[model samples]
Target: MKATTTSAIVLAGGLGTRLRSAVPDLPKPMAPVAGRPFLAHLLDRWIDQGITHFVLSVGYRHEVIRAYFGGTYGGATLDYAVEATPQGTGGGLLLAAQHLPADAPFLLLNGDTFFDVPLSQLTELAASQQTDWCFALFRTSEPGRYMGMEIAQDSRITNLRTGMEQPERLANGGVYIVHPRSLSGLAAQPDTPLSLENDLFPRLLAAGQRWFGLECPGAFIDIGIPQDFHRAASVLPVHTAQRTEDALHH
Candidate 1:
């Protein structure tokens, strides 16, 4: 059977401390890429993928994001979950996830990064595995920067941590398809700062929840640091154009 999830929750709340010099006074997702906000580009791709609804977890100068894209964009409905203080990625996702339907899975993406993944294909993989959640993984040399996860022979994720050693490590691509139940056991409350990489995911592993990591590759870049932020302007245009072309051909 096809998965019953139709929406995605985007983590758009972080304070871009590293990119503050180039993109001051704006949320990281609002950082301009090729004359448009980076989030807009992601949204465009999601819409092309047939996603019609989105929940944006917003904080740290969130009004800027709200002002730019109101309740809707490109025929996709938009909703917002505001955090009064820094609640980290896990807390923000848990809060935003409350807006999702209780029985279905919803997609999640990091606001400051882009990974050209086939959303529908990933969802299909999740259904075939019968897991509560699935994450996209990319082979990378710098596992220290992005969290590293070990993929088992059965395609289940076994371990995750920062600073994982050299070769054979797959970087977390910051994209997910999660059944709401997968997040229901989160150990933190809304007011607390919680990290998915540092806290929530480890607990899920300890609990033996069925989750898989998919080795996905394509135009991937994050503007979390100054160097990557500077590089995104050049890299994303190539990616965005290719995504558009693919959408048309499909």
Candidate 2:
């Protein structure tokens, strides 16, 4: 069977309280890193992989994001799903579910982290594994601060941070290719904040849902803190240059 065209849902709803001192006026996704909005870099990379549609899940200062990116960027069509209240990652995804097709797989990414894995490779890995869900895992130099994923020898994600299962060392890289049917059990609640990591994933594991992890060797940086933001900015330029050189050679 031919691979299906992919659509991306970028979870851009966080208030960004941690980086507020540095970027008080804009949403975290709109925060500047290396001269342009951090999201622009992500979009550029994904567009290179042939992603033509994007659904931005926006909440705080959403108007600013809409004003800046408008309907499209660099030929990719942009769609917005605004959340009236703060919704967790799972909630944001559920809200955007209506925009995605039920039979196709779609990409979901956190707004604050940059995972530089090749999009084509990630998509291929997801399809080849025939898994219900796939998460990109990064072997971080320091894994204490981040949420970790324990993967078995067969490359299946055994558990996330909360579980007691132990396996090879790998951390969640915050990029995912999810089959729409895998989320069929998630129901929106009134007051509870649901997280994909803490809530849905554990249940999926219990139910024997196939969740695989793909290791990302490229730079994975989180822009949530002040120092991390600085580090990302410093690293991104060099990373982009290297990618350009590689593309030229290929």
Candidate 3:
């Protein structure tokens, strides 16, 4: 199946406080990996997956990104949602979403992380379940670092945990297919510094929103820390090229 959701919102506004020692100049996403801006690798993969339009939710040295990839890259139309102040992930997404059509379902990705999920499968799951949100999940023993999720037999997300409370569980991959209607309520809380992982998702889950999860087999890399940032220099180019190769054969 092909992915119908071709537009995406990339959360690219991270301050990269932990990574400032290594990547002092650029925003987290623009930090160089494999001789190219890290964001370029991300966009290249997504564009290969059929994403044609992107709304970058950027702040904290966002100009570096804007000046670098103005309007378009990799055949995708690029748009910017500049945050006057630092809006966290959820708030930045809410701001960027204004650029998309009201009813369309779109992909959401973390700019600092690369999860090589099959975008078509994400859209397929959402369409089949008639769900508002579908998360691409990965099994992780180190759940302390990421959001731990409990998924039911039917793939409905039943619970969420913050830390190692649930070790060796399915963790959020920072990749999702989300409909705008599911996030419409958040539009009201524009000024609040809402986090997609820490704040908004928990609220939506409690509200009995239609949320599901699918475990994906893919290379997942988060360059939020210095170690991973360095690791990406070796991992990203090979993994992304493999992705393009896999896409071609399929």
Candidate 4:
């Protein structure tokens, strides 16, 4: 059976320190790409994939995001989980995840990065493997820039490392299909920064949770730095056009 995961959580609360020069007053996800907030493009793609509800974890000038998007965009319901202070990625995710339905798998995304992995494929893999978390992965020739993942032949994720200098390895695409039960024991501690990649995921792996990786050959981009932020202005519009064409042809 095809997996039924339509709810998504976006981690949009990052401080955007690296992109501060370019987007001095906005949250990283609110940085404009192709004349619209980067989150808009992210939401558009998920909406195309049939996601009907989204919970955005917003901090660091979050009002800009809230004021612009409001309660709905492109026909999908938008909800916000505001952080009064800086909570790290994992904390923000846990905060936003509370808005999701209690019993279904949901999608997770990083607001600054865009990896167009098909949601259906990720959910299908999660169902077939009965995985607690199904990671969408992409091959990157440049290492040390993204988290490296080691996968067994059966698709089980055997290892995770912050930096892998090896070439053409699978890296986390910043997209995920997660079972709600996976977050069972994880709670955000006050004033403590929790990193999803640096802390929670490694601990979960050590505990032998069912984590699997599915490599996706999709267009990927991260608008975290100045150069890439400018590059997104060109790349994203072309990607949108291409995706629309692909849908029409299909």
- For each candidate in turn, give its C-alpha RMSD to the true structure in angstroms: 4.3, 5.0, 4.4, 4.4
For model 3 the local lDDT of residue 186 reads 69
TM-score to native of every candidate shown: 0.91, 0.88, 0.92, 0.93
Residue 82, model 4: lDDT of: 90
lDDT of 1 at 68: 77
| lDDT tens per residue, model 4, 1-250 | 7658889999999999999999998899989787667888888899889998999998898988888777877778899999888889999988888888778999999999999898888999999999999999999988699999999999999999779998788999999999988899788775997999998999988988999999998889999899989988666634434333223322
lDDT of model 1, residue 20: 93
Q: What's the CA error at residue 42 for candidate 1, in Å?
A: 1.1
**How good is model 3 by TM-score?**
0.92
Better of 1 and 4 by lDDT: 4
- Candidate 1, after superposition: displacement of residue 226 in Å? 1.4
Question: Model 3 segments beyond 4 Å from truth?
Answer: 165-167, 188-191, 237-250
> Residues 1-250, candidate 1, lDDT per residue (tens digit)?
5545569999999998888998887899989887678898888777778888999999999998887788877778899999988889998988898888988878999998888888877898888887787999888887478888878888888887678878667889999988788877563365679987887888788888888988887788888887887778777634335333223322
Off by over 4 Å in 2: 1-5, 162-168, 237-250
Candidate 2 on 1-250: residue-level lDDT in tens?
4445469999999889999998888999888787678888777777777788999988899998887778877678889988878777778888887788899898888988888877777787789988888888887546356678878887888877742234445888889888898888676553776777777777887988889988888888889988898777776643344233223322
- For each candidate, the alpha-carbon lDDT, in order, equals 0.82, 0.80, 0.86, 0.87
Best by TM-score: 4
Better of 1 and 3 by lDDT: 3
Model 1 pairs whose backbones collide? none
Segments of candidate 4 deviating more than 4 angstroms:
237-250
lDDT of 1 at 49: 81
